[model samples]
Target chain A: MKRILLPLLIVVVPVAATVLWAWWPRTTPPERVSDLYRRYEHNPHLTVAYIEDFPVNDTLTVDVTTIRALDAAGWDTLAKDFRIEPLPDILQKKLNEGKDLVTTFLAPKVNPALSMDTTDLLKNNVVGISQLIHTVSVFSIETESQINAVVNYNLKL
Target chain B: MERKKLKGKELEALLSVAAAEPDGLPGDVAAQATATGMAGFDAWGRRRQRNDLRRRCLAAAVVSLLLCSFASVTAPEAARTSMVVNNGTPRAQVIEGVRQILEHKL
Candidate 1:
């Protein structure tokens, strides 16, 4: 009985600690797309954007130009916000054309101090235009920059 | 019978008359009836008919292509967007607002 109890405690403690470590929240990340729109309202500069349900049979294409522009900006951090599970034929063309789109989810806060690569890429470019598409449903939506870094690029050296 | 190939100058004269004549038959009156009506005229007629058909088909293809392009440019923007908020914050507050708007419509 003693032997069994000691072994159980040894296994349980480590398992619990591992679980806690895995589950523990590190820092409060930025908001997601939906949150940004809600917090900012429909300010145009910020919004929750997505391409709507696209049909499997219909050949009509629904392109979210916003994602391409955003991809150019480098805000496509999370896989949930950038992946298109099974992309449509036409949308795939745009994606191939260096269009930045995300089907994955990511915290929406832009860390100015972090990296400026995305911002530099999007310099002089527009932002906050969300696509609501419905040509094919196999595709996904991507998040655009709420406050365009291009605007900053225009101002700063 | 041996075939007589017309010279460039003769072909030019023949072509000029053919264009002006409308029927595209040779200018020589003696050859009119016996030149197979117009030297492979059946073949020419078939060619013209095929060309007309091809032109019409090409025009139709162009129109359909234009219409599809227009439709692609004009489709309504649609999405199945939902918001999931965590904890009590503006994010949650806004998601609630959006849900309310959606629910009201439904």
Candidate 2:
């Protein structure tokens, strides 16, 4: 019995470990986000971006081209299904006055303690959001922002 | 047949003849004994070699099978994420929803 069990154990343990390592679901936000980006990076129609900023700055701009593309791509349903916070009062007032708002999305304040390093922000959260947005909607708007630079720099040369 | 008992002199003569013979068995008997012994060794050696080959082949097969299984399981990470993303929201519906938001807001 001992002889039989020893050989069986030697064969079974490594196979089981390899299987678990390969199939285990990724739980971290960073892992999920990176995976999402890799899956969609090959699509020519989609573009992904990431941005990092020091201090909490509440500013977002969405260009007309992007808006039009979102409209054409049929993103209204995604926005409705997902929880999209209303535009800030200032932006709302501008909208009421018929002023074009440039910012497209703004994230709420994050605690400094919870704030990840700039590298982590780019690798995980930023790319994750970009992929999430693209998955929900299709947009052709190109914004001249730091995110564009960061994303382009990260792209394969 | 009637049993015949040898006289003391006859018995002495037979013993002397046996003692005078060489220590080793006759040539034909020795050759036969050596051949039988070697035959047993050769058979055992062949069986051992076959068993070793069989064990090695089984090990290689097990390792290959394990590697293939691991590779197959890991190769679908992207596909797995995509499945999770699109679980409830169909791609077409998401796209349509985005388009509506653009039209209404812009």
Tens digits of per-residue lDDT for model 2, A57-154: 12533211111113323344323423434577886786677654332332211311133345433322221111223333222223335344323322
Q: Which 10 residues in a row give candidate 1 chain A its minimum summed lDDT? A: A132-141
For model 2, the TM-score of its B chain against the native B chain is 0.39
After superposition, the stretches of candidate 2 with alpha carbons farther than 4 Å from their true spots are: A1-13, A29-150, A153-157, B1-74, B78-106
Residue-level lDDT of model 1, residues B1-106, one tens digit each, is: 3334454455456555666775545436326434544455434555665675566655555655555555444433221222222322233333232222222221
Candidate 2 C-alpha lDDT tens digits along B34-102: 444434434554565567556765775587577758665665432222222222334334333333333
- Deviating ranges (above 4 Å) for candidate 1: A1-157, B1-33, B37-39, B79-106
Q: Report the C-alpha displacement of residue B9, candidate 2, in angstroms.
A: 54
Top-scoring candidate (lDDT): 2
How many pairs in model 1 have backbone atoms within 3 A of each other, for residues 3 or more apart or on separate chains, i.e. clashes?
A: 22
Looking at model 1, give its docking quality level.
Answer: incorrect
Error of 2 at A107 (Å): 5.4
The DockQ of predicted model 2 stands at 0.05
Among these predictions, the greatest DockQ belongs to 2
Docking class of 2: incorrect
